[model samples]
Target: MNLAVIPARGGSKRIPGKNIREFAGKPLIAYSIEVAMRSGLFEKVIVSTDSQNIADVALQYGADVPFIRPVELADDYTGTRPVTNHAIEYCRQHFFEPQLCCCIYATAPFLQVDSLLEGYQELHRQQDKAFAFSVTSYAFPIQRSLRKINNGVEPVFPDNIAKRSQDLEETYHDAGQFYWGRSNDYLSSKKIFSDHSIPVVLPRHLVQDIDTEEDWLRAELMYQAYMRDHN
Candidate 1:
């Protein structure tokens, strides 16, 4: 079976009720659930959350809340791996052994069905690879990044300051949308950012991280613009 585990803890400090907050007309998590269902890729789409409210919202949107995440895995410091591993183990105990598992983020409002499909397909094709996840190219070359020091700014890489942007290697970052992994890879707690994984690149316009109020506003604007262009 293929399983989708969406880890949405209730304690969002940066933005209260962030996982369930409204975004572009529905709860933030609804987007992730809807897209996963629409993709028709999973035998089960489950939301592993500590909030009863979150569980209700997830079930309302057609995702199963078979179990509430444990307190230890629901804290701010808990990483995605352990939460996912726990979910996988739970499924195993219940006789729903997932062959492939995908960890879809609740805040990923920009996630698309095609991107998820691509990651799924890529992971299946690369047997040697342990995982596949979404990524997007950095808007600007990171080699020329700056940092504030006292009253002045300084180049992070002084040696790359003189080099043209075109001469620098292009870089990509985790889109924080979804991750596809073999059940064994996840159960083993393998790292996602290693050479063992593949990346499903997404367009920069279709990616945004919503961590703060400003980020939320920017994401809304971006989502509006994307919808207009796509529709």
Candidate 2:
């Protein structure tokens, strides 16, 4: 069995009610729900949320809200690990334990059904590995990243400043869109990235971590571009 869990809490300090907020016509959570449902990959698609509104919306979009997330796990300090684990364990106790579990964000509007299916395909191709995730090449080298200081800002990795970007080894960052892992690894390891993990590189233009208003705008633009080209 395969299960996709979307953890959405009611509280949102960064952007209030972010989970249920409208994005490109539908609620933000709708995107992940829609993609997961349409992917035809998962045996079960569930949303673990603390908000009744979110649960209703998720169900309307064809996701199962089996149970409301605990208030303790719905707080701002609650990391994704616990929420994901809780959902996985919940399903394990009720239904058959899933072979693979996907953790998708409620607010990730850029997560397309095609890319999600591609991720599942990659995961199947490398089933020997513990996990697989969607990622994108870093826009800038981490070595060239900056840090704030009392006097002035300084390079985080000063040694790489002299080297050309092309010469530097490429490094990838989690696109924050989604993660797919074996159920046992997810429950036992407590970490998403595993020794047997592989990164599925997505185009930079298609990747956006929407944390703020600016990020939301940029994602909308990029998604529009994607539609124009693909359609």
Candidate 3:
């Protein structure tokens, strides 16, 4: 069996009720739930949420709310590790044990089903890897990036200032969408982006971390652009 666990807490400080907030149309979390369901990749799509309202929204969209996440794990300080670990343990005790597990984030409205399948297949194809997660290359070279010095900007890598952009190596970042790994690997490791993991690179436009109001607007705009281009 395979499991997909989405962690969503109600105490969102940046954007109130961000998880259930309407995105392009449905709730933000609804996108993740829908993709997980449509992907046909998991035996169960479970949402680990502290808020009953969020749980209701999750169930409304066909995700299982087997257990209300503990208050301790739902706090602002808590990260994905503990919340996911709790969900895995709960499933083991009450339901069938999952051989493979995927941690799908609640705010990932831009997640795609095809890419998710790729992760599952790729993880198995590469047995040496412990996990497979979404990632996207930076639009620009990071070596040529700048940083805030006391009063003005300074090149992060002074040596790269003279190097051609084309000559620089490309860097990718976590798309913050989904993570697939063996059940034991997830339960044992604190970090997912290790040498043991493989990256599933996604188009940069489909990758947005919507943590602030500005980010929400950007994501919406990106979504619109994506639809227009794809449609």
Candidate 4:
């Protein structure tokens, strides 16, 4: 069986009620749940959350809330792997054993069905790989990055300052959207950023990290622009 686990803890410090906060027209998490269901990639779409309110919203949107996430696992310090592992074990005990699982983030408003499908296909194409997750190229070359020092700014990599942009290697970063992996890999607590994982690249315009109010505003603008262009 294929399972999709969405870990949405209630304690969002940066943006209170972040997981279920309204975005665009519907609840924020509704986007993730809707997209996951629309992808048709999983036998089950589960939302593991500590908030009853979150559970209610998830159910209202057609996602199963078979279990309320434990308070211990719902803390700010808790990571995605442990929450996912707990979900996997719960499924094994109550439902059919899941072979492949996808961890879809509740805050991923920009997540696309095609990216999820691509991750699934990549995992199948490379059986040896442990994971396939969403990523996107950095907007600017990281080699020329700057840092504030006292009253002045300095190049992070002084050696690369003189190098041409075309001469530098392109880089990418995690889009924080979703991750597709074998059930065993998640259970084993394997590292996600290593060579064991492959990336499902997304366009820069379609990627935004909504951690703060400014980020939220920027995302709304990006989403509006994207919708206008596509529609």
lDDT (CA) for every model shown? 0.94, 0.85, 0.92, 0.93
Q: Against the hidden reference, what TM-scores do the models get? A: 0.98, 0.92, 0.97, 0.98
Kindly list the per-residue Cα lDDT of model 2 for residues 50-154, writing each as its tens digit.
Answer: 999889998999999999998889887989878988999999999878988999988788887877777778878886777778889987877788899998998
Off by over 4 Å in 1: none
State the displacement of the C-alpha of residue 202, model 2, in Å, after optimal TM-score superposition: 0.9
Question: Per-residue lDDT of 72-97 in model 4, one digit per residue for the tens?
Answer: 89887899999999999999999889
Evaluated against the true structure, the overall lDDT of model 3 is 0.92
Best by lDDT: 1
lDDT of 1 by residue, 20-112 (tens): 999989999999999999999998898999999999999999999999898888887999999998989898888588999999999999999
Which residues of candidate 4, in runs, are more than 4 Å off? Answer: none
What is the full ranking by TM-score, best candidate first? 4, 1, 3, 2
True-structure lDDT of candidate 2: 0.85
RMSD of each: 0.9, 1.7, 1.1, 0.8
Clashing residue pairs in candidate 2 are none
Candidate 4: TM-score?
Answer: 0.98
Better of 3 and 4 by TM-score: 4
Model 3 agreement with the true structure over 1-231: per-residue lDDT tens digits? 999999999999999999999998889999999999999999999999989999999999999999888888978899987888888889899998988899999999889999999999999899888899999999989999999989999998999988998999989999999999888888885468789888999998789999999999999999988888999
With a 3 Å backbone cut-off (N, CA, C), the pairs that clash in candidate 3 are none
Which 10 residues in a row give candidate 1 its minimum summed lDDT?
187-196
